[model samples]
Target: MSAHYVGQIAPNYVHSTMQANSDDDSFTFTVGKLDAGMAILIGDKASLIEFPSLLLPSGVSSGSVVNIRVMRNDQQERRQKDEFDQLQEDILHTFGQQPPKAPALRLRNVTQTSVTLEWDRLSLATATLLSLDIYRNGERLAPIPNPLHNTSTKLSGLDLNAEYTFHLVLKTTAGTLTSPLIKTRTHTISDTSGISVCFGHVAEPELLEASKQALTNMKAKWSDRIQIDTTHYVCTDPRNPGAQEGSQGAGYAKAMQLSIPAVLPHWIFACHDQKKMVGISPFYLDQDPPNASSIKRSVEEVLGKQAPASSATEADTSGSPPPPVEKEPSSATTTQDAPLKSTPFAADDVPPSNKESVGVEEVSSSAPPPPIITTSAPSEDGDAEPQSTPAPPQVVITSSESSDRIAAAAEGESTTEDAVEQTQTTEGAEEDADGEMDEVSLGGPNGDDEQEEERRSY
Candidate 1:
C-alpha cells in the first residue's frame, strides 16, 4: 500500500476543541485494524506500534492524511552510550601506553668531590611512583629516597679525575620509567700535598698560574710526592683557621696536618739547604711514630740511596735526580740515635764510585767574603746595645747543584770535600758586611757589585 504524505508537524500544542454543538468539531481514531508492526502518526512524526491502539482528538476534516514510520528508540540510545564509553577507554589507554617524559636534568654547583642533580617530576596519575635510582657510568648506584618533586639531590664521594654519567629512573607501580641520560665529566681533584702547599696563601692570578706550572713540574718529576686517595685539591681557597701574617706558614702547616687524616697517610716535608736535602717525617697522633728507620726506608723508596747530604747537594738544580739506591746503615752510626740509628739505609751504603761521581765542590768559592761590623743603637735604659738585623738573602746551593759538580769533580779526581769547603768559605765571606752594607757588599766576587750599588742608590 502507498503511504500518504502529510504536512509538517507544528511545535505548538493545542488540547482544546471547537465550540460546536455537533460532534464534527472533534476527530477520533484507533489502531485497532492496523498490522502488528505498523507505525502510526498524528501528523508528520510517527511512533512504531505492535498491535497497539492510540486515539486522536475529533476534527471536522474527513480527508486528512497522517504519516506513519518506524522508529528504533532503544537501539539508538544503546549506540550512543557505547560510543561514549569507548571514547573514555581510549583516553585512559593512551595515557598508559605513552612513555614517561623526563625534563632536562641539570647538575648545579658542581665541585671536585660533589655535585647536585635535579629534574622535573613525572606526572603519570595512574601509577604510584616510589624512589628514584641514580646511575654512574653503567653501574647502578643507591636510589635516592623520597626525591623532592622539584628540587635536586646532592651526590657525594665522587672521584674528581674520573668522568661520570648520571641519570634517574623512577620506580612505579606498573613498571620502572627511565629518564634521558646526562653525561658530565668530573673536575680533577689534585693530590693533597698540592692543596696543603697552597693553603692560606692568597692565590692571585699570577700566583695561581705559577702554582699550576709548578704543580705540573712536580707531578712530572716527583709523582710520589702526592697521595692518590684521601686527597682533594680544588681551585678554591677556603679560609684557614687562626691565620695571621707572621703565623701564616704555621697556619698552612696546621691545615695540612688536619687534612692529612682525611687525605694523606704518608707525608713528609722535604727541607733543602746548601748542604743537603732532608725529609722531616710527618707526625700523626694515631699512627706509629715516624722514626729515622722508617724515614730512611721511605726516602730510599722515593728518592734513592745516594749519600743523603752529598749526592743531593751536588745534584743539578735544573734536572731531575737519578733514582736512589737502597743501602744498609753503617755499623759505626748504628748507635747514633733511636731515630737515626734504626735506619737500614745510610750515606756510606751508597756507592761512592757510581756512574757519575757527584762533586763536593765549594759552591761559593767564586764569591769573596765581606767584612762584618756591629752597630749599637741607644736602648730605653740609655745604654748602647747591638741591634740585630737579617742578613741579605743569599744564593743557597741546592743538592741538585751539588750532584752536578760531583760527577765533574770525580772526573778530575779532585777531592769533593775540598770543593765543598771552598764554596762554604766564599758563602761565609759574602754574608759579612759593614753598617748597612747595601747590595754591593752582599754580592759574590764575580757578581756585578757596581751595578748592584747603582741600583741600590736609585
Candidate 2:
C-alpha cells in the first residue's frame, strides 16, 4: 500500500512466487504511461499504481507488460544497520571519546602596571588545534603564538592597582573550549614586594651586598640581566671607572634604553626601613641626596615664626637679650583721654601695687628699662601681617565687653578678620569712661618711692 521504499531492493531477492499468499505478494501489470519521474501501471483488476520511472526495467516502453512485486526485506535492513554501527564506533575511537579540553589559567606575578599569567599545557586530546586566544574583560586581547609550546604570558601597559578579568579560549577540530575566568589586581605603588631590582654599575661591593640583603628583607626580587620583568636598576655613578664594562655595565645601557628607574642603593635601604615602596625620583643615581637641615630651613621660611610667650617672666629670662629700642611714640598724648592710646609713661607714674601687671620686674642691673611693645590688631585680610608699634607703658583697664572681644580673637571664635576688626572698634568706644578712672587710679601719691624703685630695677 505504501509507495516509498526505505531498504535496498536487489535482483537476487526477487522471485516470481511465494509459498504463502502468492496472489497478494506478486502481481502482473501493464505500463499505462511514463512521465518524467513516475511510471503508471495498470494491474489485472485495472488498479493503477504510481512507481518511479528510474526503478522500472531499462528500455521498457509505454504499454509494456511488467511484473510488480512488493515484499519486506528484513535481511537487507539488518545488514545496512550493522554497517552504520561500525562506522559510528570507528569515529568514537578516533576523535569522539576524548575531545579538546578547556585551557587552565592562573596569575603568576602582579606589579604596578603589569601582570604575569601562566596556564597548564593545552589538552588537544588527539584533535587538531586551530588557534588559541586570550581574552581580558570579555574582549579578545591577543592570539597565542605556537599555542602548544607556550604556556605563560606577560601583559604590560595595565592600570596601577586596578582589577582585571582574564580567560583563555582554545579552538580545535573537536570544538571551541574556554577556561575559567581569573580575577587579578595589580600591585599598588606602596607595595614593595612587587619591586624587581637589577644590579648595575655599583662601585662599592659592600653597597651592592647591602642592597641585595635589603631586597631580600623586603621580599623583592632581583636579577643580573635586564629583562622585561626588571623594574628598577640599582647602581652607583655610571660615569665611574669600569662602569661601562660587561656589555654596557651589566645592563645599564639596556635599562636606559628601556627607561627603567635607575636608582641608587639607598632606595632599597629606605624601602626596607619604611616597609613600603618610596618614590624613585628623589633617589635617582644622577641626583644628590636631600639634606635634612636644608629641608627644615625651607619649611620655617614658609610658615614664619611662632607666637611669643604670654608670661613676662618667661620672655625676660629668655637666652636672647631684649630687642633694641626703635623709634618711640610721643609723650604728649595723655592717658586720661585715650586709655589704650600709644603714649610714653614716666617710671614714676605707675602705682607700686600694679607694677607687676605692667610687665615690669625689679632687676639688679643698670640697663635701661625695656620698652613696651603693643602690637596692632591684624588687618581684615587673613594673611596680612600684624603691625607692631613701640609705645611706652600706659594704664589700660579693659571693660568686660572689651575683654570678651579680645578673648574671642585669641580663641579663634570668629574666623573672619573683618569680625576681629569690628570687635576692636567697638571695644575702643566702650573704654572712654573706664580709661579716665584707670589713669587716675594708677597715678599714685608716692611719686618719689616709685622713681626710686624704678631706678633700682634699671
Candidate 3:
C-alpha cells in the first residue's frame, strides 16, 4: 500500500549532490509531492541541511500542495565509492612503473693498430642491462660485456691503410642509444729516394735544367736495373748558392746550402746482386795534381828502363803472351855448409829473356808510352836545383780492392778486406818478366781493353 500526503513541494536536490554537513553520506527523494514543513532524517553521521526548500525532496506540487517522499541517501554514497575505486586503479596503472634511461656515451684514445671504447657506469639497481655492441665501418662487431660497468675495452687487428668509423650502443631494459660515429685513419709507409747535387755558381734556370737532366738520366739508367725506385731531385739558385730551391727553381730559398753533405761526398751508384748490394761506386772526376810530371819520372827510375818497341810487336803478332813459365827451386844443404851461399838468382839480376824484354818498348808499348824526360844535375851557380828525388808517379789504379771497399762503405756495408789482404800477401809474385808488376787497373770492372774500346767507340 502507498501512503501519500498533500503539502507544498520542495526543489529537486542538486543533481547527484549530498548534504554539506555529511562527510561520507548523500540523499535523494522520489515522492510525488512534499510539504513545505516536511522533515527528512539522514544517517547519524549526516548533518542537517538549513535550506530544506532549496533541496529536492521529491514529487511535484502546485499552490503549496503537501506531499511526502522518502530520501534514499546510500545511492549517492555508492556512486562516489565506485568512482574513487576507478580513480585508484588508474593511478596505480599510470604511475606504478617507468622505463630506464640510456647510458652515458664516451670516446677513448685511438691509434693505427687499435681503438678503445668506454662508457659511464649504469644504474644496476633500477634496470637490467645486457651486452654492449660496437660497430666499425657500419659493420657490427661482437657484443662485449656490460660496457657501462666494464668502462673500457680494446679492439685490435685493424687495417693500417683504411679509414674506420666507430659506434657504441648500450642495451638496457628499455632500449638502446648509439653514440655518434667517430672517425680515424691509419698511416702508411712509402718508398723514397733522395738525390743531392752541387755545382759552381750559375744561372738558376740552367742549373735547374741540368739537375733535372742528370736526375732523369740517372733514373733511366738505374731504376730498372737497380733497387732505386723513387727519386727526389733538388736544385739551388746561383745568386744565393747556399740556398736550396725546388727542381724548377720556383720555390722559396732554403736556409742551408744544397751541396751534398761532405760525409756523403759524391753520388753513390748501386745495383742489387744476389739479394745483396754488390756493385757500388762514387761518381767523381780525377783532377791531375800539380808536379805530376816529376812524380812520373821518379816512378820510371824506380821501375827501371822499358824494353825495345820491336819486342812488344813480335809478342803481339805471335798471339797472346806465352803462358807463365815455371821456375825450378834450387837445392842447398844448409847455412852451416856455406855462409852467404850463392843463389841461382840475385836481387837485381835479370834472365836473358827478361833483359831482352826490358827496353822501354815492353813497359810503355802497350799504350802510348809516357814522354821520355831528361834530368841534369844542379849547377854550382844556382842555375838549377838538384832534381828533387824524382817524385814517384801517382799510379791511380782504379781497380784495387780498396776501391771496392770504399764503394761498399759508401753503400753502408762492410768489405772483405781480409780476403784482399791474403790475395796480395806474396810480394815478389807481383812482378812479370818485363819488370812491370801486376798493377791495380783503374779502368772499371770490365777490364782496361774493354774500357779503351768503349772510349774510342763513344
Q: List the residue pairs that clash in candidate 2.
A: none
- Candidate 1 lDDT over residue span 205-232, tens digit each: 4433333343343342222122222233
Most accurate candidate by TM-score? 2
Query: By lDDT, is 1 or 2 better?
Result: 2
Candidates in order, TM-scores: namely 0.27, 0.44, 0.22
Worst 10 residues of 2 by lDDT: 389-398
TM-score of 2: 0.44
State in Å the error of residue 1, model 3.
Answer: 74
Which lDDT values do the candidates have, in the order given?
Answer: 0.40, 0.61, 0.38
Choose the strongest candidate by lDDT.
2
Candidate 2 residue lDDT tens string, 1-458: 21223244524322322222355555566788998799997765466767788877777779887765556798878898999999999878766687777988987777888887889998887789999999998999999998989998878899989999999999888889999999988888778788888777777665566667667766789887776567888877654324544434536777788888788777776676556767788888667745322333222222333222323355567745445333333223323333332223334223222333223323212244444323233444644332332222222332322454333323322223332233233334434433533432223357547633532332
Rank candidates by TM-score, best first: 2, 1, 3
What TM-score number comes out for model 1? 0.27
Off by over 4 Å in 3: 1-104, 123-127, 187-458
Q: Tens digits of per-residue lDDT for model 3 on 1-458?
A: 12233243334553224332243222433333335764343322342333254343354442232223334566677898999999988766554454554455554534344555666665443456766787788888878664554666667677754688877776766566676677866433220112223332234443334333434433322121111111212222223334454342211122123222211111221211011111112322233323233333322322334333544576687865323222233222112222221222221121212233234224333443111122233444756432212211112222223555334323332223342222222222323322453344323456557644632332
**What lDDT, from 0 to 1, does candidate 2 have?**
0.61
> TM-score for model 3?
0.22
